[model samples]
Target chain A: MTRSAVSHADLTTLSAHKVRAAIREGAYGGHTAGLAAGKLQCNLAILPERYALDFLRFCQRNPKPCPIVGVSDTGNPHLPTLGSNIDIRTDVSKYRVFRNGALSEEISDISQVWADDLVTVALGCSFTFENALLRHQIPVRHIEDGKNVPMFRTNIDLVPAGQFSGKMVVTMRPIPQAQVAQAKEISSRFPQAHGAPIATGDPAQIGIADLSRPDWGDGVQIREGEVPVYWACGVTPQNVLLDAGLPLCITHSPGHMLIADVAEDAETTILTTP
Target chain B: MTRSAVSHADLTTLSAHKVRAAIREGAYGGHTAGLAAGKLQCNLAILPERYALDFLRFCQRNPKPCPIVGVSDTGNPHLPTLGSNIDIRTDVSKYRVFRNGALSEEISDISQVWADDLVTVALGCSFTFENALLRHQIPVRHIEDGKNVPMFRTNIDLVPAGQFSGKMVVTMRPIPQAQVAQAKEISSRFPQAHGAPIATGDPAQIGIADLSRPDWGDGVQIREGEVPVYWACGVTPQNVLLDAGLPLCITHSPGHMLIADVAEDAETTILTTP
Candidate 1:
């Protein structure tokens, strides 16, 4: 099916499992931006079991950017805690293959690359809170502009664990000055989804020299009366792993995530608010 | 000073540092039961640096039992995050020395046993939440009975990390049927202090065959119209360390804790309700 044809369906009508199945069977291979509405979707990170402990520490130390939702048992592609019959190797519509820290391939299935020594980590994504924001009638600039949220590397250093160490990367959103407090209260409820803004107003306070240039994603225009708010981004782990020059790493490609059986609202209340 | 003289002089009036000073100077060695009222008191764990990372992982995996209040920089003995001027070796009123996982001595000061490779971990104690429970009018059976809270070993296996792994340990408190909900809500707010009860009624559900036979502390009577509630106990780490058969380890004797500068209320709000 064409990408445009796939995008036309009312996502509100389908369940998360059905959407994931479509993605798994090559019936769909596109950005999951607005698909599987009201379901928890996550950023995927699959690595060797040897590095799992340290990675878990890294996430614990830096919960804002790496709020872990579910960690698959070693070598098991199914995350029983996340959803029944959800296969990590095939659930995500697209996977970025990295070998020795370099981009090796982008494919629909990693069943060929799957190993008994591998471990999968599912991290909460900002999209969870973005839905919360929209629910509260807060306008998200990037989504309205039909572009990815702009992300930047900051001077803030992540708490290192073993071989994983790097600076924090954050995503930017523009909120009206009057609505900033509401934005914070709404977002803070989603701790699993990066929680509240790390910094607002002056980008330079967090070491960003230019708001126009972002390290990842397309930058959105910051209009008058709107203040730029920043949040810890999920892209952080992938970036850190790449920086560490690990021999192998696998992650879901940007905008293509693993949709879980967990209801978005249920997960939002459990993870974000708690 | 006599214990009677010290007990009457507003024992809860002093700061954590002053309280420790009195203990260190041999002026006070009685149970730290009502001292430093609102401060965060901790269960102490000291081990060689080689075991630090594994223990950290163990704590991470079993957060309910070992909610870390502070971890000293290796061999530093000073816990800066917990409090300024807090010296792990001297601040705790009493210390239990263990050699090859066996009890060696209970001393007032461990300055002589201090080592460059030792790492000190300050874990949250139930005292913080016990105060909350009492304030909310929930009867704490053990406290009213003038006994240590009954603790038991459960069939639930803790997530093992490295060499540390064992069954979970729990502390029991009997609450009136009507007050059980309030007790859970209040205690759940203090995740650092063992958080909410792990099991409410039948101890058998968590693998405890008898209510009278406790692994540690004094067992209290469960009266009519009351239910026994269990919270993960701080003694879990100590028990696990002993089971690991480490060459050396040290902990605060039961009821003798290291008082911290963090307010009890702050810790309560930080974990449960956050």
Candidate 2:
């Protein structure tokens, strides 16, 4: 099996586990943006056990950007709460290795670098709720334009936890002026998936001086009749981790996610098993 | 002003600040159950700054029980988040002073015992949502019967945060079988007021051995055709704080509360001045 072989296969028809197995076998190393439909995909963060407590506290303090779905036991490569066979070392399609707050390497596997005191934290991603929005007939401009969602660093400071402290990052989506309330109502139900919009209308109020130029991801064009809505972005935790300047940290490359067995709309509860 | 004088002057109809002034002046020491209607009522938690961070973490972890509305800055007896002129040491109708986890005094004021290193936390109470339930024509059995809502210590352990770890405590209300969905919908709106019920159905499943006998509040009769619904109780935080054995702690006496400027039905935001 190879990366091209998996790509050649029916991408949307594969189960999450099958797709993960293919990724683990060096058969796939592509973005997981729309791969496994109806499955819960997660943003990954792996840090040393020493910072686990503080990181956990940080997630608790700021749930909008970091709704924790699963936490791997200390030094354990397998995540029991996300999926039964998830091996954090190889399950992700691609991994971004960070050292002292800077990206050092991009790899297909972290098996050789796995340490005995590493802890993996899986955060709920916006993709799940974005799918829900699309299902409800909400227009997602970025998806239609075939570009990554526009993201911005905001003046809104996330509640600081221990040594982890930074401003919140947000993703923007332009909604038809009349659909703003409906959009908020639908998204508010998914607190695990960034909940409701943090700000709307004037982006400058939140310190975003330019909507045409985002700090991360490709910027989307806002139509004349549309309003830009801001949601806390998953990039927040990653940014905070980088700012902390940890000796070693690992995260999934942007747009690459860990697809879990849990359904996208599954009731939010602590999973009894992986 | 004397208690009778304050009561006769329609002081209860005054704003939260004026009502609190009456309480501060030793004019009112009665239960705050129905006074200052439409205002947010909070349960109090005062502890030394050393334990404040851990307690905040605990509240963040177990939000269903400790839905934090306001947290005072270190040694600042005022809760600016809740209301202007809201002094924690004297605003509540009554205060229960605890020393080494044991109840040491029940007083109307704690000014003499206030410390420079103490942190005050104002948590949401069920009264806010119970009013909503009643407004929606939902019957609150305990309130109808003029009895205390039954509370039980469950076997469900809260996610531990530092030194604060204990079993969850819940309050029970019997709702009509058909109104379970309605109850859940209405209560879910008040996340700061414990959101929705943690469990609904046979109480034994969550480790409640007897429904007629409660560990804390007076047990009310469960009428025929009604199903028992349990909600995470505000008492859980106080109990957990007691169990932590801090050198000194202060909380509002049961039924007494610290009324705030925020409306009970107000939609809350992370930056809603709190």
iRMS of every model, one decimal?
5.9, 5.5
Clashing pairs in 1: A100-A247, A189-A272, A189-A273, A190-A272, A191-A272
The residue-by-residue lDDT of candidate 2 on B1-274, one tens digit each, is: 5555455246657887788888888887778887788888988899997787567656755778987677666677876556878788888878999999899999989999999989788889999889999999999999998888899999988866557889999999999999989999899888779888999999889999999999998988888999999999999999999998899999999998888888887655233543
lDDT per residue (tens digit) for residues A19-70 in model 1: 8777776777778877778778899889997787667657765778887677
Which lDDT value does model 1 have at B109? Answer: 87
- Candidate 1 residues B1-274, lDDT tens each? 3333355265678877778777766677777887888888889899997787668757755778888666665678876556767777777778999998789999988999999989887788999999999998888888998899899999888867678989889998889999999898888777668878878999899999899989889979999999999998999999999888888899999999888777886612122211
Residue-level error in angstroms, candidate 1, position A41: 4.1
The per-model DockQ list reads 0.15, 0.14
List all candidate RMSDs to the true structure: 5.6, 4.6
TM-score of each: 0.75, 0.79
By summed lDDT, the worst window of 10 consecutive residues in model 1 chain A runs over A265-274
